[model samples]
Target: MNYVILAGGSGTRLWPISRNSKPKQLSQLVGDLSMIEETYHRLGKNQSVFISTNSQFAPLIKKLLPDIPAENYIIEPDKRDTGPAMAFVAAWMSLKHPNNPMILLPSDHHIRDKRTFMEVIEAAENLINSRQVLINIGIQPTFPNTSLGYLEVGEEISKEAGVHVYEFKRQKEKPDYKTAKKFLDQGNFFWNVGSFAWTPNKFIEAYKKFAPVIGDHLNELIHDLESGGDGSEAFSRMEKVSIDYAVIEKIDPRQVLTIRGDFGWADLGSWDQLFDQLADKADAEGNLVKANWHGVDTRNTLIYGPADKIITTLGVSDLVIVDSDDALLVTPMSRAKDVKKIVELLSYKKLQQHL
Candidate 1:
């Protein structure tokens, strides 16, 4: 099986520190290593790993993950959404390594349990090897998160290596607060972690059947690949839609299967989520500090800055303070998810340096 890490996100939610030149995946947000580095090392050194990113980030990702060979870097010519991006990957893999099952993984997630993660991947691989079906790894939801998608699962179909495999009933993409709470209350719903596994040919056939426009463009991509072309023109012609809307939601529920993954999983997409991931390391006052910080009455806040700068906060609570070289962000914890609005404002003001 081929493990392809998707690393093409701009990461606007984590602004100032996460810039256009260097996104969150390249930043060392968790520990000493970058997020992409942590993700790569989590898979261990034995598996066949590949990177799926755009040309702009390809050089930086290559620098970060030097262990992966040049041929393993699948560079997308355009900045299309996941629908076209994934279909292009399927086309490339089918042309190069046909019949091999591939797993699409996020490059910037934090997984606390590596052993259990590998076990879940092994179970998914086993199921994919036995059947020609798309497999999605579902993480047990810990909270009523309206930002993430939810997967409604049915009866358990089978068990692979102690992992319970369920029938994927349907996917609800970013529901309202009430619906999210209802999903949390129900025991059958799981958070869609976006980790999927299937053979390249199977996914290509899915595209051909459901999203025929993308499937038509995929044929041009395959032909371009065979004829030593980059397929940029063919890629840009496809619509910019997510994989869920294009193929996954349109496919029959019986055609898709999901496995329950109990391993510690968290998508560090925003500052609030990152604070939650590192909450265990907080100080007595519930402050997660990464820089030289001195607080008098700061509680339940996240302080991140450069090593040279000293961040001091007094009489502040439930806040996110991030100090970069050029920009400083101070927002209440409740509004940390709206940092992307600042990025949008910067883009509108033509302030590319701050992005």
Candidate 2:
């Protein structure tokens, strides 16, 4: 199987620390190593791995993962959303390795149970070889998370290599709180973590059936690549929509299969989520500090900054304090998810330097 780690996100929710120049995947948010580095190590060595990112990040990613061959990096010319980005990847891979199955993995996710994670991935690969279906690795929802997408799973179809495969009924992208709670109570919904497995040809076919314009653009890209030309023109002409909106949600339920992954998966998309993931590493006062710190009454707070500067806090609780070189973000834990709005506000104010 060919593994492609998606690392093109701007990570706006983690802004100030996660900027456009250096996104969260390239930042040391969780541990000493960057998130992408952790993800690469988790996948293990001696496998056909690739990094799917934009041209701006190609050099940085290459410097970080020098072991990965130069030819393996799939660099998109422009910043299109996942729809065009993934279609471009499939087209490129189909031209190079058409027979191999491809798996799309996120570079910023935190998975504690690596053994179970690999087991599920192996099962997905086995199922793909045995059947003709687009596989989506769905996580068992631990709470009513309205921020994440939900997959409505149907009856069990089969069990391949100790992993239970189910029929994918439909997908609900970020439903309301009431709907999310109802979904949790129904016990048939799984969090869509954007992890998908399919052959390059199979994915191209799906685009052709559901999104003909994108399919047409993909063909043009494939042709351009064969003719010794970059696919920038074809990619720029494609729609800038997400994969869920363009194809995944519209695919025939019969042709889609889902695997339940209980691998302690958590998308560290926000500061609060990051805090939750590293909760076990917090200090006695419920403070998770990464900087030179001296706290008097800081409880249940996350202090992230450079080690050169000392961050002192007093009588602060349930807050997130991130001290970047150019910016400092101080927000309550409840409002950490709204940090993306700050990025938007900065853009609106034309403060590109800060962004």
Candidate 3:
């Protein structure tokens, strides 16, 4: 099997820390290593891996993974979203290895249970080989998250595949509290983790069925890819769309299957999400600190950074105070979602340096 790492997100939602040039995947958000590096390590042995990213990230990735082949990096011409980028990847792979199966993964997600994650991938690979169906790895939702998209299983493909994935229902965009509870009660919904697996030929066929323009461009795009063109033509010619809208969501019910992901996963999209994952539960004062720190009246707050900087808090509750040498962020937990608004406001005021 081959691996395609989709690494072209701007990570606008995680601004200040994640900038346009340095997205969250490149940032050291969760652990000591960058998310991309961790993603590379998590994959099983003996798999050809391809990284799809923009030009800005190319050199950085090369520096990080010097052992990886230079040709494995698939640089997009522009931000055309996942569908087109994935089409290009599939088409390219088809030209070289049409029979080889490919696993598509986002570069920025945090996967905690790697062994279980690999098991899910193995299961998907087996299903693809035996049943010739495209697989969508869907994570079991741990909370009522409004930020993520959900997948509804249509029917069971196999009773003993350990998981039964049916047809993918239309996406529910950030459901209200009542609707979210209803989904949970239904017990058939799974969080769309965006991980996918298919043979190169299967991928191209799916694209041709759902997105003919991208499928038609395969030959010419592959030529440009081989010749190492500037990527101007391909980017301009391809339509900007997501995989869900262009293919999976649009495909006939019989062509798809959903595989439940038991691997602990998080998109790492927001600080609040990170808080939920990393906050020390043992802190009695509700003051979560990564390094050495002293606190006063700082309840239900998170502080992350160096031990030298004494992030002293007074009369602050339900807040997130992060102190980096280049930037300092102080916001109530409820208002953390508005950080993008802060980014926009900062941009409007011509505070480009801070951005």
lDDT tens digits, residue span 179-204, model 2: 99999999999999999999999999
Please write out the lDDT profile of model 1 over residues 1-355, one tens digit for every residue. Answer: 7899999877799988898889999999878899899989998964589899988999998898888898888888888888999998899888877788889999988999899889888988888888878999898888889989988999998878878899999998998989989999988999998888999999999999999868888889999988989889889888988899899899998888999988899888899999989999999999998888998998999999999999998899999999999999999999999999999999999999888
Residue 280 CA displacement from its true place in model 1, Å = 0.5
Candidate 3 yields a Cα-based lDDT of 0.76
Give the range where candidate 1 is weakest over 10 consecutive residues by summed lDDT.
Answer: 45-54
Q: Give the clash count for each candidate.
A: 0, 0, 2
Models ranked on lDDT:
1, 2, 3
Candidate 3's residue-wise lDDT over 224-322, tens digit each?
866857556865687888887778877775666788877778777877777777655438876667645677777888776666777677778888776
What is residue 169's positional error in candidate 2, in angstroms? 1.1
**Reference-based TM-score of each model:** 0.97, 0.97, 0.91
Q: What is the lDDT for 30 in model 2?
A: 79
- Residue 217 of model 2 has an lDDT of 83
